[model samples]
Target: MNQYVALDNIRQELTLRTIPAITLWNRLEARPRTDNFDRALKAEVRDALWMLTKQWQMGEFRGDDAGSPVTSKIHMSTTKLSKYVAGNHDVQVFDDTVPLEAKAEQRPIPFTIDTQKVSLDIRLLMGRQWLKMIASTGNFKTAYVTKYAISIPDITDKNDVMVTAHREAWQQVAATAQRCMDGYELYIYLKSDAAHHAYDTIPMTPVQQDAIDILAGKFIIWYEKLYYQPLDPENNAWKPDFLEYQFGCSAPQGSGEKVLTADQYCDGHLDWYSVDIDPLSTTLGDTGVPVAPPKTYTRSFIPVPVTFDGMPDTRWWTFENGRTNFGNINPGTTDLGKLLLMEFGLVFANDWFLLPFTLDAGSIANIKGMSVTNVFGERYWIEAAGKGLDDDWNKWSMFTLNTKGNLGELTDPGLLVLPVTPKILESKPLEEIRFIRDETANMVWAIEHTVPLMTGASKRGSEAADELRKRYQQLLDKDISDGTVVSPVPVYKADIRYQVMNGVPENWIPFIPARMEGSNRSIRLQRAAMPRILNGDAAKPEKIRPRTTLLREGLDIDLCKPYFINEEEVPRAGTNVYQSYQRSRWYNGGVCTWLGIRKQTGRGEGHSGLAFDQTIPVKKAE
Candidate 1:
């Protein structure tokens, strides 16, 4: 709507005396601050009347009924989580030496399973040490020690005596220490009966026990280090995973202790919020345990305002370069987290304070009440942020555990849990298995991307599956070529007219939806396998089992049983579970080592293209 009174307006405006022409444009300027403090555009009076006026308009001058809290008498109670039980094991002490995360997730090194020696690592490492020990003790003849000797390549230019010893010998004395080893002890560990798990020579002698201890005990101790270790074991310290194993730390002290045995720990990571008190009740899916007793203590401390890296500063006459800019926040209605955080920083940041208090890692802590002494010598008792009827949905607070029980059970108010977990280490996944739901098939597939081999190395699932099938094929070939069979006929020809079922990847172990417990309505993913018909023989069907340990829970038993995963664990989006070697140091500089499982969210559902009752026509030869 441009008004044009052209010629007349120009003549009328020519009579102006003092006023200059006014113009308007979008404001833009080059901002270059070589020196952080630039006073060119800064109004020096910003800290004067302008600040006061702004604060006044925002009601900052409104006097509070009482002065701000200077110190807080925190009456807090804590119970040492004195019990820890791994899986269904007996309850034992919850040692506070190592972080609970390490304890809960640590994998124990089982020496053997009945007749079989379980690990090649145990044999290799322990056998090498045994030969060294023997040589050092002069217990065995030099010839005998040399017979089972193990040698590592000396990485030193020690032309002096087989090059410069084990180089950088000053770093670790053990590295340069001369040992009676020639790598032959690895063979000894494999062949010798003394190294076997069930080597029971009738009338066992002291020498035999000593040999066993050196071979097995030392190997076991290599991974299992005590927090307050004695001189001998500490001296024998070796590299290990982020797992520290102790003898008597498995105990269930109170009601909520059962949560540890549930599926949450199945993946090794412990998320306190998802845990339910009644883990034994399958209906709840995720369970937690309500521990007995509440501890109380009183300590006064000068409260400090809670601060975060990007949080807004209180002063208005300045700009925080990288700090949160509330003005720049373009939050949508669904961005509740961002919106709430921004709102809190802008309006309620001053109301929050932090206190530093230490608690044992496994135990939960609750601040019963707090008496705050203000700057005016006025004391005010403060209640918890969520101090109201426990059943009220509106009452909310952070870090509080949920009260769990059946209906009509009088529930105690949930306590603020401070589980002593730490930011521990996670190595590259040794075994990766993804549990993906196939909605069309009404089944779940445990796709093993990575699998552990017998040689203590990880292999791609596809390659490992191929190797496994090759092994089975070799066995079949050996059987077919046997001379005892008189003109052994192949059960079925490889060039068949029809195929019964479509083949899926051997690594994709199927989990059929089965009735949970006895309820047909409630289904769980029960581990199932496709039958492998070797040499096209339907009668000679074999189980195509999973190679990944996460999917082979109950299959290795004498009587193979179905392993079931909770349906909720594998949701529509799916679940990714991985086992890896973890290594970290605890609070006391004690090395933590373990092989633990970690679970993450999968991308989405997957299609295995698994089909049954298929028909295939014979292909014409070219």
Candidate 2:
């Protein structure tokens, strides 16, 4: 068996360096260097350099202190005094998210799971030096008192000062408690603890439970005084503990009146009576039988000159000898004035009996059988007597004869019989022109007279009337696009007249001079050809011929003289000749066509016309 050494002994020998264990030590240290070692070392050096560079660039390590010092004083709790009073601490039993209900019910309440309950009070303390200063100053006293004298003891030591400070701070906290509790209230059942565990089990009626269930899951606040009741002393009746406690449910009342049912409320209170009842029964007695209404007749008679049978006659009539002069008649004293004078004469003559007529059964027969000649004779009779003739001359004569007698009644004793000349010309051109002008004027006057009536019939400033006025103005302005007017003149005459009479400026007319005829024709031709040229169909090869024969005659070959040409390799002949050469034996036989090169031998021939080398032996005529 080989001698064995213990591990502890070997470790001692190695530690003591007494054993020659260099090979073992070298074997233990001889690990092959892997790529990861270099990579790890490089990564460590990069990280260190990056950290150092970042620290230098940021200047974060240039501050005076490495860590901040604590400046606040530590508070020590004492078991002798209540922490609530000494620390001025208040415990909040309820927060805003807490659900408070008027009654208890089994319903899910979605209260916030992360509700935070914070203390209402915060600890406040003065420094020990400040407390000592207060002790030195002693308690403040009033200069004078009206009601009573007061005594204040001076502070002696730190304990007395501490006691006074604590007392004053507690007093201040107690004073602020009422203000803090102004809108706050806590409800408690008889058996409920400070955590309100018994509130969930309170007794509630079905209506109260239903109310709680209806308002469930809603974050709500309830005050204690609103629902709390106290026993009455006199009648032992329960009453509200606080009569003025306000419940904040401010919803509106129902729409219907309290005193009325739905139908009565809908019908309303006003009395209604039927309007179909007759009012005449009570107002008037049996004498109120409807009387036939009096007949209403329209006057229909106008004060204008009346023609035969009251018809408006436009026919112009002349007496046999009405006038002798040929000058233009005054328009004011023309036919209408004469007709008016004739009417006045007829009435006057009938009243004064200047002429007479006879009436009998034969006269009535003659009146009924009257002809145009008899009517004209009657008009002549009145004109000869220098009297006016009524439009109904026949009837007037018959009436005069029937009522007042005889053929001759003193025969115009007072009237003057002036010799009157008749108008010979009936249709003068100038008279017709004046008549047309008068008629047009009358029409225009009639239209203008109706404007006020039309405006009254329509609403004031209506669109219809405005459009009518606009169209009327356009008519007056003669707004025609085709160079025509209301009178429709010839186009050429109209153009000339419009240019001259309308004062049209020369610049306003788009004129092109006749001198540009050739250019304009060329432009038009080019315009007509543009589409064909753009479509690549300007002229077909078969239809078009070149203006110059240079290209066709191969004379345009001179145009290529500016380009460089190679002397060693000359170009071939024309395309047709080149193509023929390619098909012939010369090109196929590889003949050189270059300008300065010698021709080669044919395909079957050698360079010096020998079929093979002359030095080699050959059979002569074998």
Candidate 3:
């Protein structure tokens, strides 16, 4: 009976399972399985990851956070995901977000890079595309763009605006791509050019090179601030000496609004210290109110102008005791004035008196036989006689007086004056001969005293008379015999003479002539008569005025002699003799105050034969 019950239960269970099994079989027939499911899942995951990576790299994430973690709940469309999973290689991560079809036909436009404008067949990519910028130095950078289009504001119409905008947009894209490239060269991957999948490089234009150079200059300032020492007291070094740092658009002045594009600001302009930050309130602490530190600051340096004392004039005289107060006479007050004083001491502004002398006929005749006694008491015979007068007789009238003295007489007091003579007592015109002029005057009188007992009426048989007659005959042949009449016509003019004494006192500086103008004979006399100052034991003998021919129609004087001052030796005396000669030569003769300390002339040459301690009996002049 139990066995019969078990069989009935099994049959009932089998009958219920058969109906469900048939339903399952029908459902299985409706839907079949495929082998590519795992591959599809894997592809979907890969596509998702790629999209996430691209979004993160392009700064498209929330708050543009690249470090954000990737989660499974990222927003994605099923259709796009399916396309990637289906192995559609054309599927881009931004395919859905950006438009992929042309909204309108794009018209080509010319774009400027720096100063160059070029028309390119540039077209836009409707969808965002990836770009890789490879620097020449092997650095890599990436950027993304939705389209190649530029925006130009304030256009006349939408069409024109669109064209300009497209050009500008292209420039913006290209500039951004090239910003981090070495030398700022541009490299880009375009959607239109399918043959070049990799980034193609564009050479830098001149404008681009200039822009980079400016950028480099600015960057170096920052780099120096970080790595270099602005002031190192230990090494005695400092930053480059500059007045100030400037920051502004480097566009040329008046380039117009159109030329002042974005590229103009790449290089900064020069800044002057005049427009610097306020000196009274420079630092933030000094502002008294809280403020952020300036983004840029400048360092500047200014030097002070030099100041000095002036020089004395060439005609400025100082007594032997007056040298201690030389600082009293201010010299070289102005730039040009100082240069003149230093180069040519006190140039004569107007012609002035050179010596104290009268040019009248009686005075000229009186000085004929007189001797000029120098400070040394040495007598010099007066040789040729002439006079100078300007339009104003009272202001200027003097004689050209030549003297014949010993060779070594040009020391201490370098000048000679006719202090006392028999002719002076006879004429009784002035106390002393003084004041010489520039204009030449007639030779009034020369040595006309008859030779003692040697005139035409004297017996010619005596030996002394014969000798005197021979001399007189020789003088007559030369047309200059005493008593021979001559017209009162002007002969020769006089020029100033600069005589360098043999020995100069330690505290004394002689008056070196600046400009001397006259005949060659006058120039020679002026130069040859200069005393050569000696060093150690090498004493150079003073010059002596040679005996010249008597003046018949003109003054007879020597013309040849070495007159130039040696350049190497000129500086030792703190003067430029040759330059002085050149400048002073144009002026007529005049008396200039000899700026020197006068002293008694030494008489060593006259006493050379006497013993050092011996005294010689000398007869006094009556």
- Top TM-score model: 1
**Pairing residues by index, what is the TM-score of model 2?**
0.10
Give the residue spans of candidate 2 off by over 4 A: 1-42, 46-51, 69-73, 76-622
Query: What tens-digit string does per-residue lDDT give for candidate 1 at 460-494?
Result: 77766665565555445555566422334444444
Over 467-557, each residue of candidate 3 has an lDDT whose tens digit, in order, gives 3234333433334324343324322233332332223211111112223356343311112232323222122433321111111111121
Tell me the TM-score of each prediction against the true structure.
0.66, 0.10, 0.11
Q: Please write out the lDDT profile of model 2 over residues 274-309, one tens digit for every residue.
A: 001111122211222222221222221111223232
Winner by lDDT: 1
Where does candidate 2 clash, by residue pair? 321-420, 321-421, 322-421, 322-422, 323-421
Better of 1 and 3 by lDDT: 1
